[model samples]
Target: MKRSELLTRIVITIFSLGVVALPLALWAQTPLIHARIAEGGGWNPDVIQAKVGEPLYLKFTSDDVMHGFAVGQMDMQPVDIEPGKVSETTLTFNKPGIYTFFCTRWCGLNHWRMRGTLEVTGSETNPPEPASPPLYVTLDLNLDAPHLAEVVPTEKASARRGAELLRQLNNLPTYQSPDYYRLRSSVQVFQDLSGSGLTDSQRWDVVAGIWQSNTTPEGFAEGKELYAQNCAACHGEFGGGDGVFADDLAAAGTASMQTMNGDMAMSMQTPANFSDPQRMLGASPALLQGKILRGGMGTGMPMWGSIFTHEQIWNLIAYMYSFQFDYPR
Candidate 1:
């Protein structure tokens, strides 16, 4: 081969190698975030800063166990970061606000604690309208107070049975209104139906039918999935409050109390038992919505207002009521 031709071929090979290496060099400069259990420092440099309308590149690697990364209230697929392996994601925001990013995988009892903040700064092109307060806030609900049902049903109510009886009843009262149903407890509705000449059991069945009517099959499926992914760890798969993390939560509370003295010690209570007829029947959908959005006062329940959308919360509330009422599947 001629010397000039050989020299030109060598230069071409060198240029090809530089093109490949340049991208890796830039990627290496991107910040590498580390993930671990909440007990093990959670996310290092948990707070991130970026400007709106600019792509934010992120790199993640798990320090201890497998972990999944996702931003709350944002539409993005979760990226799993296996132990000692790296995963990457890109994000862009159009609005300026504090967004939450959390670990999707349940690592331990404090898995929900594995949350970080992303602060985006820029002017909004189309600002959102001011929001109205939730119904619980508007009605001044005291969530911590006991809400007990005055009347308990002798048997589990069925929505299917109620539908049959409802067709025969002449006067369909105002209690059947969806507006009234959202704000009042089941017991209240049952009592309101007394003037209709129906038996106590029939009244209970009517309430079940009303509750089932408020939700659709699609919404039910969505709620079930949300509960399984987010609430099952602490609230149990069936909402009996005997989940895998329930004992750990109680133990953590006890340990916290032991380390302190007097009322300053946190009083973390057991997760709510949705299967309890009395407990659930006494609560309104609005009240439950507040609890979900604001979380428990000291019950180790994390606030999900930022994580779940309004519709998602309502769907979850409807699905929870299914535990108390026997609805036609």
Candidate 2:
């Protein structure tokens, strides 16, 4: 062939190779992440590198049973990952930070352990403002301390009665405020009401009113749904500590009596009984919020700081108080 013909053939061959190679390069950029139970190694490629304000494509598949894919602190619906099938989602982050991703479904006893992280890097045009400390932290509470109510109401407190009573009282304690309710327990509120001339039972009713006023019926329903999905396995449906894992937890505690600090290990202890008036009533909404957000230290309670929003955490706290008081339907 002539030199010109040979040059034309070389150019055509190079163009064909580039067309095939471009697609392969793009495919290589997106990785397939695998999901399995914690025992089976949890999420494969658990650490993902991403860029801020750029679309990140994640492909997922379950190695065993069905699993869910969700990023913490994100406002996206979870995608299901069925065994032998692939599920994918594309996300773009506005800020740069380390974000956690985890399974949304209750896969097993160790479901909470299935968590991973995404590291996003980029420049921010408008940096986020600093957040204030949580109320429990600001109050400097010892979350592990046993807080028992000094006075237990003879009858269940009624929110409907309290609302009527609230309208009649001219002077009221600051207990009605969200900040007050969050920081002070129902028992504390009852103590504060001693000067109000209301009977002990009436004081309890007023406390119930305060709780009811802070939350809505819709919020309670949402909280109940969240508890059933996330907490019922370890804390019974009725807020009793007789869940299916209670016995196993007790056994675990018996097996490991002491921890590294020579203190009794809370991990082996059964979950807290929300129905216990003394314990539940003594815990303020802020205290409960702290516990739910931070999780129990070495108590087998997983930290949900990343999983739930601040409003959702508050709603859960309000529902917890429902086990102690009777709110109007």
Candidate 3:
């Protein structure tokens, strides 16, 4: 062959190879993140950097038991990370913010502590506006305060009976408002109904009906599933604060109390007992929502603000109140 022709053939071959090799190089560069229980150091290299509108590839594997990987405030479902195997996912962020990535599985008592930050940086055509403060914050609620109800119902408040009573009452539009339901506790509602000439038991039933009206069957189901998946390990299936890790948490708290160094000591309080009518009834939906969003501050509860959406958080709060009221399943 002529020298020119030979050179042309070599150039074509090199171009073909470059096209194929580039993708492989990029794929190989995707980092592998290790997942382990919080006791075992949680996620390795927890802070990940990414660009908005760019695809970020990640590979994950568990060092101990099975765990789940998910990004908060994103619409994707969690990908399971199994021991001795790898799970891969590619995510593209549209907005620029510090997003949280966490384990969805209840791996251990510190499962909620298994969290990391994903720093997504880039300019957006329409940047998101700042969010207003949550209702609890706006209301200046002291979430740590003991908010036990002063009055206890004679019997389990029945939503069906309450619904019947609501039909007889007039000029009580506030009782039907979602805002009222979100801010006022059942005890407050019971007190409000005192002038309606209803017995304390009847007032309790009315409160239950009001709660049922604010939520739907679908919302309850979603809340139930979320609670079982994320909360049942520490809060119990029956809302009695006797979950698998309840005793472990109590023991951890006791051990911390004995430590002389306050800063180093952990606050491992027992999970809230939802079965306690006074406590649950006294807590407004907004209070419960705030607690779920912010988590228990140093109380062994993990912050869920990034993990769950606003509607999902409200749904969870509705289901929580169900433990006190006899709402239809």
Best by lDDT: 3
lDDT of 3 at 216: 88
Candidate that beats the other on lDDT, 2 or 3, i.e. the better one? 3
Go through the candidates in order and give each one's C-alpha lDDT: 0.88, 0.86, 0.89
The sequence of per-residue lDDT tens digits that candidate 3 reaches over residues 155-219 is 89999998888887856678888888999989998998889899889889999999988988999
What lDDT score goes with residue 162 in model 3? 88
In angstroms, how far off is 327's CA in candidate 1?
A: 1.2
Q: Per-residue CA lDDT of candidate 2, range 150-212, in tens?
A: 888987899988988887894565667787788888898889888988988898899899888
lDDT of 1 at 283: 96
Tell how far residue 75 is off in model 3, in angstroms: 1.3
lDDT of 2 at 17: 92
Off by over 4 Å in 3: 1-19, 261-266
Per-candidate Cα RMSD to the true structure, in Å, reads 3.4, 4.2, 2.6
Sorted by lDDT (best first), the order is: 3, 1, 2
Q: For each candidate, what TM-score against the reference?
A: 0.89, 0.88, 0.92
Q: Pull out the clashing pairs in model 2.
A: 253-268
Q: How high a TM-score does candidate 3 get?
A: 0.92
